[model samples]
Target chain A: MNLSGETKLFLGVIIGTIAIIVLAAVIMSKPTPPAPAYTRNQLIPIGANTKGNASASAFLVEFSDFQCPSCKAFSSVVESLTEKYKDKLFFAYRHFPLDQHPFSRTAAAAAEAAGKQGKFFEAGTYFFANQTNFSDEFFAKAASVLALDATLYEKDRNSNDTKKKIDDDRFFSDTARLPGTPTFFLNGKQLILYDSSELVKAVDEAVK
Target chain B: MKEKFLNDQMTNRILFILSLLGVAIALYVTQSFLRKTPIVCLNSGCELVRKNPASYIAGIPVPAFGLIGYTLLVLLTFLRTTSTKLHKTLLPWIAGITGGGVLFVSWFTYTEAFVIGGFCTWCVISAGNMITMFSLSLYSHSHKK
Candidate 1:
């Protein structure tokens, strides 16, 4: 076949497209590398509600809302995962109350209030269990059920400090441009969970 | 006969360019859908479509199909330009490919309008591109003889 200038040019573009696509596929398919240490705490800042050893090399931070169905679904798994890696994992839960979930903000505040009383995770048990049943007085009932100080729970849950903490989590969520609820970061790398079991596998890997 | 050859060359060039444009549009849509990023569209239609389950088929983002189709067209158009023999062989394949593309895009457009109850600007632009390429395919087919 006799070669033409335009033909070569178009073929060049076609070849270029294929080359770029192959390069991209190769890059995207490789496992994500660990994030640098300095940027690690940017998402898991000080005073954030946390469990496990602060200095542990494996850190897991979750941006979640109590009223989110997916978050609730993953709550039990995370709880058990944390228990399994209690010594090795440093876990933090940030609140990202989507506007669609009307009670999520209040539930976040309630969780923080329980944090103040040192029963945040315990309160979480109730919150995740009764997501669909949240009412204005649900927080109070949960506090009562957990045997927390009723007066302090009411005062703290309604306090400006609790509001600020939840607001700060929201601010961080927006700053990170988090895609959706229950977004998890394991060892400073976001975990894309296709199934709940991925969490256990990832945490096991992280701790190891 | 020389004039006719030039016309076919011009038509193939036009098809190649259009296919290139389709690639760009499809690439953007595919990336946006995969990354869950909001797309540039009028009246938030892009976000609506992005969130809708219909934007995917069998868990594969819809724009991926467009990307493959357009990229294949790009290759075919360039091959047709190499020689008259190749053009004769490739022109009917181009027509068939674009004909299938038009049908698929039309179905997607209909799903967007009626089933999804919204429109993505990229999807609409892709539909237009597919239709135009199909029209060019028919034009070249008629002129082939």
Candidate 2:
């Protein structure tokens, strides 16, 4: 069967035309979605150890791991801001121990155990500031140092209360679709702070 | 028709098939974006690379670029007239660029799986497609007398 030259040329044009149409359709179909409505108070969450009104106009929630360096730095910023804003802001701390970090969850549970004695934030801040002290002895010693009720701390440390808190915090992390630790939620919306300046800007706006 | 058979009929058919699959995957991602579903990548490297905003150039996804490249290859394969030596010469160049892009994406995927801890399904599929296209292009073009 002798295939004519013209027939081959025709085939090329037809298939080429189809490919172009498909590519163009794909390119044109996806347009980036518009940015969500945002405000300052709706951007950063209040964390545990924070002393403030829950009914405050703005709330900040921090999802963090004790072993993370960035979480420690971010924690410091939050602490200063908390002091700066004192009465006007609300803060909450949620634990999100990433799978790669071995000691984060144990530290989180230990902190929750402290929470039962009204020292949750104190223990958590201590853990972040001194992450190298993640050994069982170190954590137990921190509990003793904070003067928590030893019996209750030990019970809650190994109890459902600790696991549930960790699990509950994980739920928010998943909801925010966080890719890494130190994820912050201002109000209930995901807060992406690319830099410290952005974070400060967010807090300033929230206070406004 | 010998020229047409060589450039369009045989080679173009495979390009068209591969390109269609690439387009289908691209469309699926678009739909996922529109529906606000998480861009799930079971491949660790794929997920890590995708998770990084730095992976995109000017907000355009790397896979989207792959989609355009595959589509262009398909067009070049099917639209080139057999008698034109220019189209014949261009085939390998198109395949080389496609192979290079795949190579870059593959390195990132490797880092994700071995170094990082996640996977991306679409990236793996696209890499496979590029490898297949490169093989086919070489096989078809080399056999031409």
For candidate 1, the per-residue lDDT at A76 reads 83
Of the candidates shown, which would achieve the greatest TM-score relative to the real structure? 2
Worst 10 residues of 2 chain B by lDDT: B42-51
lDDT of 2: 0.66
Q: What lDDT is reached at residue B61 by model 2?
A: 61
List, for all models, the DockQ compared with the true complex.
Answer: 0.15, 0.10
Residue-level lDDT tens digits of model 2 in B21-126: 7766765554443333345454223333444444455766656676677667755665454446745777777678667767866875775556433456787787
Could you tell me the lDDT of residue A195 within candidate 2?
38
Q: Native contacts retained by model 2, as a fraction?
A: 0.03
Interface RMSD, model 1, angstroms = 7.1
Q: Give TM-scores for every candidate, taking all chains together and pairing residue i with residue i.
A: 0.53, 0.54
In angstroms, the error of model 1 at B81 is 33
Compose the digit string of candidate 2's lDDT tens values, residues A1-208. Answer: 5545754665665677568767977886687554353443433333344456766887776778887655765777888877787677777777788776688888888888888788887887788778755787887777678898888888888898578768777775766567566766666656655434456689778878
Model 2: residues >4 Å from true position, as ranges?
A: A1-57, A63-90, A95-157, A167-184, A188-201, B1-14, B26-37, B43-53, B58-60, B80-90, B106-121
TM-score of chain B of each: 0.93, 0.71
lDDT against the true structure, each candidate:
0.82, 0.66
Tens digit per residue, CA lDDT, model 1, A1-208: 6788888888787788778777876775577554333256687877788998888899898998888766776788899988888899988898899776789998998888888888888888889898868989787687878888889999999999889888888997787766677778887777666446778898998798
